[model samples]
Target: MNIYKQIKSEILNASHIVITSHKSPDGDSVGSSLGLQRFIEKLGKSAVICHPDIAPEFLFWLDTSQILLMTDQPQEVTAAFQKTDLIFCLDYNGTDRIGPDMQALLESATCKKIMIDHHLNPQDFPNLAVSDTSASSTAQLIVELIEQSGHENLLDEHIGTPLYLGILTDTGSFRFPSVLPRTHELLAKLLAAGVKHHLVHEVLNDNNTASRLRLQGYAMSQKLVIMEDYHVSIISLSKEELEQYDYQKGDTDGLANQALSIKGMKAAIVFTERDGMMKISFRSKGEENPVNVLAAEHFDGGGHANAAGGMSKLSVADTLDKIIDLVPKYFPAQ
Candidate 1:
């Protein structure tokens, strides 16, 4: 169904629109939401972003005042769903990704739902879905929507910045295999639209706090365990360890990738105790060495082949042991 054309049509016809993403708002989630909002404004309409939770502190620089967090204001979020005529689900495929509260509101709403994402196995909830696993990010799809829907003339710095940020982060700063020539071509357009690429990199990367560095150091030096036999690295941090560093969300954002950088390491798994449960993040290199298998089958989560997320109700030590025990079965020694 001409995805670009239909989405444009829906936006033009709808009076009130609400945008949504997954619970844990990452760069892709925030960027896609903001980028699409700007695009809708360019179309002479408006949208309010309703996320299940707040974004990490690192992304607070973007203009996110329009976002209504369900964690902060559930009544307002419910009202938005009740009044909106259209909904745009970005980044994630399933309603389950937006947490139980937002999921129920989305399910009960009779609004026309449109999903634009770059993930595996999109759900059948949306009236229109644009799921392209190969697209670097959902933000990239926002740009595609603009260009393909005959709205390329509307893309400017305000719109391009967030879309560029989404592609940059989701592609691991252009290092991930998902990036292709088309991705770079879109990047060039963003740059030409005055996105100031270097400024974005500096803002995103150079804002790390000292406490974050200290926590990462402690994790890498003390908690890290390398299983040379299976070529996997594991880092598990208990709630106490996190508190010792005055931990904030996203403090361990790249810890798994750092562990995976070790020589001969096929995959890296990090477990952090937060919110009374163990949150798991998996990172790996190469398609043949997917971490999503373990994330989905064992960890109660799933995502892209190279990166995925899951959670464990088990204690940190037990969760670490469980992952170690499962490594042999899913990623046997080479």
Candidate 2:
């Protein structure tokens, strides 16, 4: 059977379902999982949403209070995994991205597995997978799945809110190039369903605390370093600097994009030190510049053409040097 049919069949057959996403869940991941969970509950099945940990506070506005935040292998999630008849992995494409614990459960579970995602290069694990890289967000794909599964009439505020958050955050509030006509149509549907648009906006964009604002200022002033060629920009923040500025986990949400705004910059990189290793985020301007390829090839990460991320064992300085060396290969004229 085709992917859509397979997904519909799985939803129909599932009596007990577990929904999960990758570690350090983003808006798309959390939003997709919650949206799918609510949809499944509407079918009168028992569904549980589980993630590695609590999502960022800003995302709390999406009604994630009931989500199971598992730091380790808890009895609840383990029992759910054992008993679940169906498992839905949303947003993430790879098991490694989901971290080892959940990956193990997914690999060992007797339940049928379905992957609903929009990310490029998905892992081959699911019994049924619905992957559309063209879709703006996994939540959007879930919306399509609901429609295909004859659950459109069941969509309510609980489901629509998270779906709206997923599309909004993934498309950068519909400003990114990924936003298409269908995306807008979905947004219109979500709005008509009474999803609180202004509240989502306020929670996502307006919840920046005073400390986060100060941290952004410090990062912009002290950490942002532009190359003389103007082809690349790098921003590095140490754990010390973050503490000094009272930075929170979600404080640096858009800092990488800020580098891209600089005139003449072709590529931008953000390097942050967390738990001794360097976390790097990459962004590029045009189709010819494949930041994701660079991330996969050079830094052990992969994502879309315009955005990517990876982690390195190297210190921040070494990672920056390594990334700088790679700049000439992509932008040779510089």
Candidate 3:
């Protein structure tokens, strides 16, 4: 499908546009949304980037303070949605990730809906969907879209920085298995477009607060449970512990990678209890196990093979027990 043509046609004709990403906004979601917003602005169109939750502080370095943070259906956002001629959903394919109110707005809006994502198993909701799971990040896909749409010259410093940030974080600083030669090539282009690499690096790596560090120490020292026999590692953090540590969202970044540090570990799981639900994150080293498929089939979540996530309605203890009971089935001793 000619994704570039479709996107260009929609943008050229539409006046009011709303761009959104998934809940618990991550680097890729914010980066892609902000980058796309700037790109649309360059085309002489006004666009609003909205997310259901506030992003990590480090992400603010992307200069997304101007972007709208929609915790609920605000009157301004709702008004924009009502009059929007087009809506672009980035990073996530399904509206389930964008939360209920935004999902309802998109479903009910008369606007032309477009999806630009890099996740597996996309839903058939958008009028034009561009989903390539092989892409390292949705920002990378947006870069390709801009190039194909003949908007390469429109990518100024503002657009370049966020796209670079998205690509960098999503690929784990270009250390993940998804990093391709083309990914580097795109990074080089973004750099040429005046993206500040050092700023982005600092934002992603050096901005961890003291509270987050303390929380990490607690998680690693007390919460981590390693089951070498099962090649499974589990880390569970309760709301009480988080409150004690004064933890904020994104404070637990890379907490799951601590399990991968153990030798012979096949899979690592991190469970964070919040608002009565267990938020689970799964990580794997090699292709020995398919974490994303496991998350989708067994858990109510899906992502890439090496890293995926799911949430359980069960309590943290029950969720851990369920994962423990299921791990042996997937990783049995030969």
Backbone clashes for every candidate come to: 0, 0, 0
Clashes of 3: 0
List, residue by residue over 1-334, the lDDT tens digit for candidate 2. 5566567777778788889898878899989988888887787766898787768777877777888766754678878888889988888898777777777877899778888888899989888888888899999998888876666788878889989989888887787677899888878878888888998887787778899899888888888888857478889888888888776677888888888888988788897888678888888888877789888988889888888898888877788788778887876655
Instruction: Please list all clashing residue pairs in model 3, or write none if there are none.
Output: none
Question: In candidate 2, what residue range of length 10 has the lowest lDDT sum?
Answer: 1-10
Q: Name the lDDT of candidate 2.
A: 0.83
RMSD of each: 0.9, 1.7, 1.5
Cα deviation at 182, candidate 2, in Å, is 1.5
Best by lDDT: 1
Q: Which candidate gets the maximum TM-score versus the true structure?
A: 1
Model 1 regions lying over 4 Å from their true place: none
Look at candidate 1 and give me any clashing residue pairs: none
